[model samples]
Target: MSKPSILSKLNSGVESSSPPMAHPLRQRVPSTAIAGLGRSLDDLAADSVATIDPALIDPSPFGDRLEYDEEATNLLLAAIEAEGQRLPLLVRPHPKIEGRYQLAYGHRRLQVLRILNRKAKAFIRNLTDAELILEQGAENGGREGLTWIERALFAKEMEGQGHPSKTIWTTIGVDKSGLSKMRAVVDTIPDHLIRSIGRAPGIGQPRWQELVDALAIDGAIKRAASILQSKEISSLTSDQKFVGLLRALCGQSSLAPHSGRREIRSSEGRSIARLSSTAKGDVLAIAKAESRFSAWLTEKLPEIYRQFLIEGATSTLDSERPATGAADSDGTMVVISQP
Candidate 1:
């Protein structure tokens, strides 16, 4: 036997129209057969899947994802075009507005279907805000995962919405320790900086922690901001941009201290040499002098030492001999007698 066609099977009973408005507080179970797979026939009657117009579904207001990868989305679109949507989306009846639905997960699929001008294959269920967030978190965490910073920001946003700590932890699939670390890293880096870096998938907790450490130094935030705003960084991919910012922050903290050396100048105040002193020795650097003069000094150094030795011997001889001289009319002096 051949496998059943998804389109024919799902479209059998449901008409392609806006889903009926549900009570604001009322929750409904899954109505689709695929959703009823693990449930009983009674449960299937209450909730079942349907194909609905794409225009009627609104994205989850509490959605955690801030950015989407365009290349990946395009690939998904191509795949769906060739082979119809294999997995169904999960959506709830819009809580406030009538005749619309809200998405729990499958945002990318919904977007592609909308762009293709086709109906969305979805499992319709009425869920509360907490249930919606839980499903969204689970789907993202288990599938194409959010980057580390993305998850951090999501957790931060959820907290800001008055969700308790335990709920946030369970929603993102992290424990207390992991959640604490995420919050710390997110709090240390400015939100604008994180957003500017974009979604850096594959980057993990350790590197982000290192970034937090670097930003703790005085003046580091200003330097990081300058790098992010640079033209060179503007053209890079999102992951490359994050790397560039990380390198800039790390470089700023690792600069070497300056040596205490002063320049010696000529009479005209032009620098001719440099003098530096250390515990080991004193150094006189004269590279600033003319090259010809330097070469001449190098060549005459031996001769100059020999002349100093000869002068020392003559001084000793003069000390040993007595003075005996005669003066001529031309003022020439000569030794007349020797003792």
Candidate 2:
């Protein structure tokens, strides 16, 4: 399908170019009719369109980082000061029935000129409401770049504005998969890591996502977050400490009694410990090198397995009976079954 024109897209809205000036004493030239050599400020104001105060103008629709770069602002101000207002900014008229006007673009220039004029006023063109909202959404949503914190906050605001997570991801123009992973990190990570994720270098969305996946273990999430926050480890890249830390988090200890480390994995609801040994003793070497270890395991494995089965059976039997007829803690006396 074809895309709607800007006005048609905004539906019932109109756009205006006038943002309220900081100062009321400013001269405005209408973009429509301007060919004279040297029009006086007052004559320019008289010949131009309507005037609106700066205070009445809405806050910038683009959110907090509006014209955030001071250097860029300075450059624009210099250009305007040197060349005067060459092109007019686009804007939409007030949507409300009672409001005066609203701005669509040229906010920075309007601000700068108002700073220059300090107290001048002049009229500007009107635009539709649809145009104004579109203007705000475009400026507010389309960012050139973002620091980690800024990106997170942007995501948060988008969520708050009832934008779907997918829509927010698409609107920001980032990879949908990467954005999905970042959202997962934001959702599942510990609070400390959440706060630290955007502030630390090398802790980008991908790294955070990986960390979240690694730390999803029970009780380990908080511990991992604490270790990450430790001052000694904070300087390390998230990736540097991540692998070893994740290994540690998986129940392997970096500082076990052995020269290497201990690895632990779950097996049938029991922790299986793998202990490493480095021995110079010949006897110890023989013990490790021989099949004796495997032989011992083979010999005892069935008994151990049978013991667990018996214990499980007894536990189930005990649980199935009523507590009122259960044996005493000391097993001195008991009824074996409920009536």
Candidate 3:
């Protein structure tokens, strides 16, 4: 089918004469864009708020990017077909186009209407950019609240828009402590884990955050991702051990006093780790295993990290790494070093 001219589609004659002020909201188009097209609302056809083609409308401008379920869409389409346009769509002027409108909210509703081939019942509003953002943010929030990834993206967007992180904390209704934790979680988790976090059974933000922080260290995220994906870490004991191993390797807490210095060697052929004889053999074994694991990770870690970027998982591992520093003293201690 031929696409309608932009002017014809948006410049319906509603603006030929100003309507009553009571409505406060009405259809509008850029005067310059549609100046030559003399159209009136009367000249355009109006369906009974039903049977209007919804495909003409576009997606939400906020980019919440909802995971639309076909079953839900079908149900909503059926309901809307039966009930007609009972709900009103909220929209704003498209940022890129002077005359085109963008869906600030009511995206799901609009989608269902489109499926039903009905005219979307909509409310026009003159809203500032800030208002549009807030409206769309809240609209996308809906009943289930935002996923960790969604929250991260939303918070990042808000930050970019000049809204302070504290404002987002307040706007999301999370306290300072909770907000702090969320930020840390978003910044520390591996993308793979972050994307899987909310949907992963029995995993919560606190635990996920802790894991993400640990995984920020080299190869930690990849190891965790592999264990989780393979279902090897399904039991509580496995989870605890995995987290413990990560803490031992990545945690910044002071290590126990040990006489021997631990050395980690990174090579293209194979990872080799050596520790002083003063260190217990058990500790040496752990360090050797860690080195081998690091080698395995050097080969596999990037693949796991790729899963995160493609999935848009909410987990974030801080990309920045601190300088290498380790201290040793005379005592028995455990060291897990990755090559």
lDDT for each residue of candidate 1 in 1-339, tens digit (9 for 90 to 100) = 444444556679978797666866566775333242333223324445799999999999875665777887899899999998988888899999999999988999998998888889888877877767766766776674688788888888778767888877766767899999999998899988888888888678877886787788888888888888888786787777776677555442111221235565554766655655322233556654456645654676576546646666345443123223333344432221111
Angstrom error of the Cα, residue 301, model 2: value is: 27
For residues 1-339, write the lDDT of model 3, one tens digit per residue: 444454666787656666568657766775421331222122212312323245545666555432444656677778778887676776655667775567767776887776666677765556776666666665554433455556665665665667766666655545677767766766676554544333332335665554655565567666666655544334434334334333344432112232234554543433355544311122333245566555654575466547545765323323122223222233212232322
Between 1 and 2, whose TM-score is larger? Answer: 1
Clashes of 2: 29
**Model 1 reaches what TM-score against the true structure?**
0.57
Per-residue lDDT of 132-204 in model 2, one digit per residue for the tens?
4333434444434444434554565566556666656554555677566556665676555544433333346
Q: Root-mean-square deviation of each candidate, in angstroms?
A: 23.2, 19.8, 18.6
Residue 183 local lDDT, model 2: 61
RMSD of 2: 19.8
Ten-residue segment with the worst summed lDDT in candidate 3? Answer: 36-45
Model 3, residue 253: distance off in Å is 28
Best-first order by lDDT = 1, 3, 2
What TM-score would every model get versus the actual structure? 0.57, 0.35, 0.46
